[model samples]
Target: MVKEVNSQELSQILSNDKGRVVVDFYSTECPPCEALAPLLIELESLYSNDFSVYKINRQDNRELALELNVRSSPTLLFFDKSHEAGTRLSGTITVQQLIGAVVDAFQVEARTLIVPDAHENIWDVLILGAGPAGLAAAVYTARAGKKTLVLKGKAKSHLELAHLVENYPGLPPLSGKELLQNMETQAQGFGATIEMGDALDLTFGHDMKLVTTRTNVYKAKTIILAMGKGQHQQTIENEERLIGLGVSYCATCDGAFYRGKKVVVYGNDEEAMDDALMLKQLDCDVSFVSYCKSTQCSETLHESAKKKGIVYYPDARVTSLSGQATLESITIETEAGTKTLEAEAVFIIQSVPSKSLLRKTGINVESKDCIAIDKELRTNLPGIFAAGDITCGGLQVAVAVGEGVSSALSALKYLRQNS
Candidate 1:
């Protein structure tokens, strides 16, 4: 069992304990923390004799959290014999990632307590993203009597953000949200399972694909890519080249790496402000750079930054990143003049397409940075298909729906021939 401890108790326990230790810093009303609670219980039950698991409430142990440089919820730290061990994991994490961390830190082989069999967890078709294309594919695949599942990404669909959609056949002018709702209901009526989650990693076997989320793993015989246009990639010079060196996309996942270091957060969304606040708590000098005008930013974020004493730059744009091998400083263009700030790290938060996953799985992409598909909507990889905006087709609801249907039919044919 995982025992809850306060700051005072934790200090004593860490100094005296000589066994393997894992402490979880979590918060109330955090969705990621809630998802991790059950996983921690499972881990404790399996490794109770080998290691002791403990939990600290960030709300109650704010001082301890500051000292430890833990800035985000659901942060996991590993220690062996009172000394830090292994790489720290934050944000949404997979079961495989947690187990790998334990094995690396303790040098012990870890196994899952409950193992699911192939027949129990495998689906006939698994679709990523819940946009118009994905939902349409689900309708076709499920109607063909195949078990279909759709994993809706955390990012909202571009179509859903539209206030009105004027041109579509067989229906009156309707709101984008209304059309999307109708499609979703149609897919569900045909017996498709839709779940909301983000895909963290993808692994492929000879005939199967594995998609790992923070809270669960999904296996399928065939897969479809219908994720919409990639999120805005950073336009600053050397930004892409410095991805893992000193540049990060997910602040919650990499905040600990820059503890106590000066960092710049370039975003205009709520997530960016949350990262700035978290970094401030870790005693790091943080600057909030909004690409939009000051009045355009969320009032709540603006007020929160003011109360926290974080430096704010309104209507600023990152022009370039400097440093040979790693990021050292950034040049920003403002209304007054160009200014360069010394920063050890930079965080650019935005939702991008799922192209990274495709690259990892050895799928071929076209010149336009999209998955290449044939007339039948089949990708170069067998049992895999591409559809919608991910294929670089015209950005229209009707086009996406047509591509989804074609891809589903091709997938059904492939399965039948192989069977």
Candidate 2:
């Protein structure tokens, strides 16, 4: 069983424990801490006789947390007798990583990888976005017998929202939705795998690239950036200054940090609603502020919120975020008027900011903020390419598809040469 310990109690247990022990330094308003709670409990059950699990609330015991150098919530420190042992883990802890840590700490039980094996395999081509350009690139690469994976974001693609598209050469006047479906079908038919998750982070390298999503990590030989311009650009005031201090883009990643504390969810998408609900489960005082109307969201989401008694401030936008050492509150401008919300954290749930992601990969961009791509649609960096509106090319579907093909061929060439 998992035991909640104070500073003195934790010290006593650690000093007396003959076997291995794992200490989880958690905070009250921390979603990561909440996420780790059940996992640690399960681990306790798995090694009932070999190890012990103890969780101490860092907020309630600040000196102990500081002494342990626990700068973040959900920090797992393994102990052998009274001395700290093994590697410590903090932030966005994965099951596979946790399992490895357990083996290193306790060497207890023969463990199997909990997630699918495919997530660990390297891909020949990895495409970002599920729009026409990305799908077209996937179709080409997958048809060329290259292992391909495409990740789509929570926000519907700009192409997916079109009412009708008729300018293309072949097909009749079809809905944008239908055209996109056909493209996805073609890519899948060519053996390309498509999954739904925003590209949260990108790590570029000489031979391989690492892309982290909400759930999985993927490695690829070549990366295709076809997400186009993002709808969210981190516009709120003081948002950047307080990134780690309080304002977070990912709910599941940072929600545990705000567990049982007042926080606000800002966005009009279904993802925002889903995150707000998750916060409620963490016992957070969650208030949702949708940029659109109450009627704009699904009835199911509305009903769910009503049932949960979660307050909603529709047709609202946060003008600014305010805090010093940590986030304190947010200023919202609703249809009614301006109001201030006392919040420990604010979750901006939207598509991952493309510009920010691009900057991290060191991709060159012109003054137009469009990617600098060669005629072959290859970016300045090797093994990286851009397509569609992101390249500041023609916005039409045909132009996007043509660029997509060009980029795919370039990526295939890069892979062949590298291999």
Candidate 3:
């Protein structure tokens, strides 16, 4: 007969056993649990002596279920030991997927893979943020068979500020949201659990780091902080008065309504090019006014602007804004002297890196306010890693994604040594 064990007994069973085991926290009333029952028995018969299977009914084993934090029925976990479970599947899982998971778990040594489940605490690595960096980390970590979770907030990302981003690799002229969503969807497809919420604070322990949010705290052996730069605002005198009315920072979010109208881009870097490219695509008469003498713009951007008939003005600095109630026009000091440019909306795209959170953690930073990290994306702290625009260079989405992936792999190696 199969063992009917409580949480304490199950804990003891794992601690004492050297052989592999499968435990299912289930309920008879749950249709999904009932559906998975036959599959569990099949796995037991298929693996034979190499594998052991156990079942804990949720109704009769309430304490065990509670202790393991099993909220839903039909949760299957492959047990390697008391302290570790290799594969965990919550909710209804397909028979083929369950078989694949079991095969992967028992064949760990042969396959050279050690993928962590959603419920497992002993992961090789955990990445923060679900943006380009975090999502990239998730893909690499999961494919490497390491446990990975991406903390994605419900709010939109900074990348979604552009109506159409033309410079990202592979796809050409894709909407920012569409591109970000594609990355997020691909990460989820690879078994990474994308949790929605912000990481409020972080603390480091002996072998693991703790991520505290408004709801719960998660422990990871290694962490990658891939949260990108924060939004930058212009400090023009009276600009704050007309916020949401005409003065805007996000062109993609508020650009469509101002179609065929005159708008001004108050930036001098690649971000300005990204913003102006989107506005120009919206059929809006977009003009680029730079605080810097020459713009460091993309080749496609320069060509696209010319093709779309967008105006470009170099060495134009905004001294102040003018309007009674709403935004009317901006007064600028150009090389030809002071000039007032009539516009309905102004988009601010400052290239300043936001590293206030990292600064609070005492991570060493560069003169440009980006966090300093080695080639492997390791910060001064042993278990902490940084990626994306928050780190040394590479402000592009693709580069940030590559950085996050490499950092996660390095973090996994670090975790394996300590764990």
Candidate 4:
């Protein structure tokens, strides 16, 4: 029921008062945009008398997009009385977010309105990530005869960026795209359904976990956290600019490449200690730096490092990572004095930021961004489990796969126990 409009048509549509106008500014080859189309159609179908839905291809209307300051795909702009009204929404959008905008724009009490229940069932297990971890989980869940759905996020997997991947066992050197394709096909062969979209909002305060995507409000019996690394509280200096240079998050993923080189592990937690040890095992000259004055790092881990002859600066904090094109050295502040450590790589392992959505949902988190889970991959929530980079677990494809399988098994067990 949504109308496709050019900028000229949109201008006229906006001039007349037809309640409130919901304009979707979208671009092609945009996953989130594709995910949003159905929802817009459904909204139009339900509330044609309340508001009108219109779509504009941003590519065909670059001038209009720029004029509106529309920088991202799937941006929803609400207009009333030939003027912009209410806040603008971009990226992944849910029916809740969309409908709320209408209610706010029109103030439903201003007139009689019919609202539709947005929640839809009934997926048994909903995996949030479509990377190696998510795909691996789907294989297990589907093979167990459980109805599993994996969401391929709007962010492309790093695998797709990888030109060549040789570490995966039994596989000859192949492109990451091919490897990912193979994994998807295998999981689908087992009857697992893979969806492409980003989760707009999540509701977990009740027994049935509700995940809202661009298309539907999903009701799932169990959920898995396989989304890639959580967003950091703040960007680190020169960090994003030097991602593949000398800065890294997952040691195991990039450790082997740095063997025999100097590397510093900057963290105060067990995960950080684990990275330091893993690097040491790979023959990297490892330096452990703690942001805290002393250390909550286990004495056992400290002693193990000492036994391995790995150096430590428990009271030091990284001040800067310097290198033009590649990482060259690390600067730190210590109780003794400011010092610089020569290093090829710096593995900065920090907790997931507290502002993460998972925290908003009251999921137990060990630190900033990463989810907390037991060995069995069970989250504090009864029907939720976590795996892969989301858990800050090694961050390697193999590690994600292993955790995905573990999470799937845990989900299956939870379902059976309850049934």
Who wins the TM-score comparison?
Answer: 2
Question: Estimated TM-score per prediction?
Answer: 0.63, 0.70, 0.43, 0.46
Over 272-333, each residue of candidate 2 has an lDDT whose tens digit, in order, gives 78889999998999998888665747455666678886788877889998889889999999
Order of the predicted models by TM-score, top scorer first:
2, 1, 4, 3
Candidate 1 lDDT over 51-144, as tens digits, reads 8889998866878987998766678999899998998876555566678889998887878634223556788889987889999999999999
**Pairs with backbone N, CA or C atoms under 3 Å apart (clashes), candidate 4:** 351-368, 352-368, 352-369, 353-368, 353-369
1-419 per-residue lDDT for model 3 (tens digits): 34567677777788898878888887643444543554566656666667788887665676666677664455777866544455677544544456667777776322222222225364456676677888888888877777778887533566777688888877889887888888888887888878865554454443445554434556677888876775343457677676545775545435554567789888766656777887787688888886665344534445655776777667677778778866788888887998888888887654212342343344687876677899888988887888887685667777888898788878878867766
Candidate 3 TM-score, true structure as reference: 0.43
Model 2 misplaced stretches (Cα beyond 4 Å): 1-119, 170-174, 292-299, 306-309, 324-326
Question: What range of 10 consecutive residues in model 2 has the weakest lDDT sum?
Answer: 110-119
| Per-residue C-alpha lDDT of model 4 across residues 74-151, encoded as one tens digit per residue | 689988876888888765554456667777876653322222233555678999988888999999999999999998
Query: For this target, which candidate reaches the highest lDDT against the unseen true structure?
Result: 2
Better of 1 and 2 by TM-score: 2
- The lDDT values for all models are 0.79, 0.81, 0.67, 0.75
- Each model's total of backbone clashes: 2, 11, 1, 5
lDDT (Cα, 0-100) at 2 in candidate 2: 93
Alpha carbon deviation, residue 153, candidate 2 (Å): 1.5
